[model samples]
Target: MNRFVRWLSASALALLATIVLLPQPAAAAPIPCGHDCLGISRDAICWEKEWCAVPIEIKGTLPKEGYALPYRTADGTASAPADYTEVREGVLWLKPGGSLQLEVFVEGDSVRERGETFLIEYLDREGRVVATATVVIRDGV
Candidate 1:
C-alpha cells in the first residue's frame, strides 16, 4: 500500500497538489486566520485562495495513522470520497459569477496531536462569486 501511495502521490495530479497539516487549537492557534504553525515539512502550509483551475489540496496528518478525505460542492452537493495516506488532492473549476467550496477533516489517536481540517474556496478567472466545497472528518486510528 505504501508503494501504491507513493506512486499515486507522484504520478497523478497529486504531484501538482499541496497538502498541509492542520492541528486544532487544543495544540496551537486556529488556522485560516494566519496561524504560525509548522508541518512535518515546509509544504504543509496554504495561505488560502479561491475559484480557478488551480488545485485545492487539504492534508491531514494522523499521528497514529487512519484518516479520511471527502470532496463536495460549496452547497454540499456533488461529492466524492477520497481519503488516503501520503496525500489527497482536489481540483476546482468555476466560471464567471461562480465559486467552489470544500472541507477537510482529520482525526487520529495521539496525545496533543490528532489531526487538522480546513475549509477551502476558489475563485474564477474573472474573480466572480461562486460555490464552495464540503469536507467531513471522523475518528479512528
Candidate 2:
C-alpha cells in the first residue's frame, strides 16, 4: 500500500509539472475597435468648388456573406441645393475588409459664411439609421 501511494504521488507530480512547463499556444492579437465597426475616414472636410469624395473605412470583422445597406445624407446646418447636392438614397455593398467613397457635391460662391455640418447616415434594410458620421464643411473662401 505504501509503495502504491508513493507511485501515485510521483505520477501526479509529473503530470502537474508537464502541464505547467509545457508551452501554450499564443493568444490571438486583439482586434482594434471590436468587431462590426465601420466609420468614415475624416470627421471633417473642406468644401471644394465642384465636389468632395469622402472615404469610408470599414474596420473589424465583416460578415462573410456580404450585404447591401442603404446610405443617404441628411441636412444639418447645411441645406441641400445651396450647400450640397442631397443624396436621397444610395445602396452600399460591403464585403470583408473592403472600403468605399461617397461623393458630395458642394455649391461654391464668393459669399463668406461660417462652417456648416451635415450627416452621412447608414441605414438597415428596414430604413432605420444604424450608423452616422458628421462631416463639417469648412468654408473654402
Candidate 3:
C-alpha cells in the first residue's frame, strides 16, 4: 500500500513538471502611436524663386483627435527673416485618417549665390521629431 501511494505521488509530480515546462504562445505586440502612425511624403524641397513655396504632404494614419504638425527651420544658407520669412505658426492640425498639405515658404530674391540650404522637421505630440525635409534655394539668374 505504501509503495503504491509513493508511485502515485511521483507520477503527479512528473505531470505537473511537464505542464509547467511546455512552451506558450507569445502575446500580441502593442499598437504603435495610439493606433495610428505618422510619416512624411518627401525628404527634400527646392526653391526656384524668392517667396518660393514647398508643400510638405502629411501622410500616415491620423489619430481620432487629430494631430498637430510642428516644424522649425534650421539655416543652411537661408536665414530666417533675412533670407526667408518666419513661419507664421508652428503647429498645423489634421483630422483623423486625413491627409494635409503644409507649405514651407522661402523668401526669394535675385541673388546669384550658392544654393542656400535650410531644414524643416516635423514633430510628434510629445515634441519628438518624426521626419525631416531639406529646402534648397537654387542659385541662378
Candidate 4:
C-alpha cells in the first residue's frame, strides 16, 4: 500500500509538471481594418513632378451588384496647385472584389524642402467620411 501511494504521487507530479510546462496558445491580434475598409497600396510615396498613381483597395466582401464610393483630396502639409494638382471630388466604382487606382499630378520644384503630406478621404452615400489615406510627398532630389 505504501509503494502504491508513492507511485501514484509520483505520477500525479509528473502529470502536473507536463501540464504546467506545455506551450500555451497565443492571443490573436486585433485587425486594423474591417468590412468595407478602404486602404492604399502604398502608405507613403515619393514624388518628382511626374504623374503618380495611388492604388486604392477595398477590403472584405462586397455586394454582388457593385459598390460606389465618393472620394476627395484634402490638403495636409501639402496644398493644391502648389504641391500637387487637386482632385476636388470623384466617384470610384468598384465591382465585387475589385480595386481602383487614382492618377495624381504632383508638382516638382528644385527648391529644397521637407516632405509634405496630403489626404484622400473616402465617403459614404450620405457624404460622411468613412476612411482616409495619407499620401506623403517626399522630395525627389
Model 1 stretches with alpha carbons more than 4 Å out? 1-117
Give one digit per residue, the lDDT tens place, for model 1 in 1-141. Answer: 999998887877554454334443343211111122211101122211211122333233222322222222232221222221211334332222232222233323333322233333333334332333323323233
Question: What's the residue-level lDDT of 134 in candidate 2?
Answer: 69
lDDT of 3 by residue, 1-141 (tens): 999999999999999999999998443222123355544434445664444444544335667787666766677668887566666338666666444555666666776777777766666667666665667777646
For 1-141, candidate 4 gives per-residue lDDT tens digits of 999999999999999999999999543221123365444334448585977766665556555666666778899999997998888778766666555666678898888899999877777677777666677898887
lDDT value for model 4: 0.70
Residue pairs with colliding backbones in model 2 are none
Q: What is residue 43's positional error in candidate 4, in angstroms?
A: 2.5
Better of 2 and 3 by TM-score: 2
Backbone steric clashes in candidate 4, count: 0
Q: lDDT value for candidate 3?
A: 0.61
**Could you tell me which 10 consecutive residues in candidate 3 have the lowest summed lDDT?**
25-34
What TM-score would each prediction reach against the true structure? 0.21, 0.61, 0.57, 0.62
Ranking by lDDT: 4, 2, 3, 1
Ranking by TM-score: 4, 2, 3, 1
* Residue 62 displacement (Å), model 2: 3.9
C-alpha displacement of 104 in model 2, angstroms?
1.6
Model 4 bad stretches (over 4 Å): 1-42, 97-99
TM-score of 4: 0.62
- Model 3, residue 111: distance off in Å is 1.8
Which residue pairs of candidate 4 clash? none
TM-score of 1: 0.21
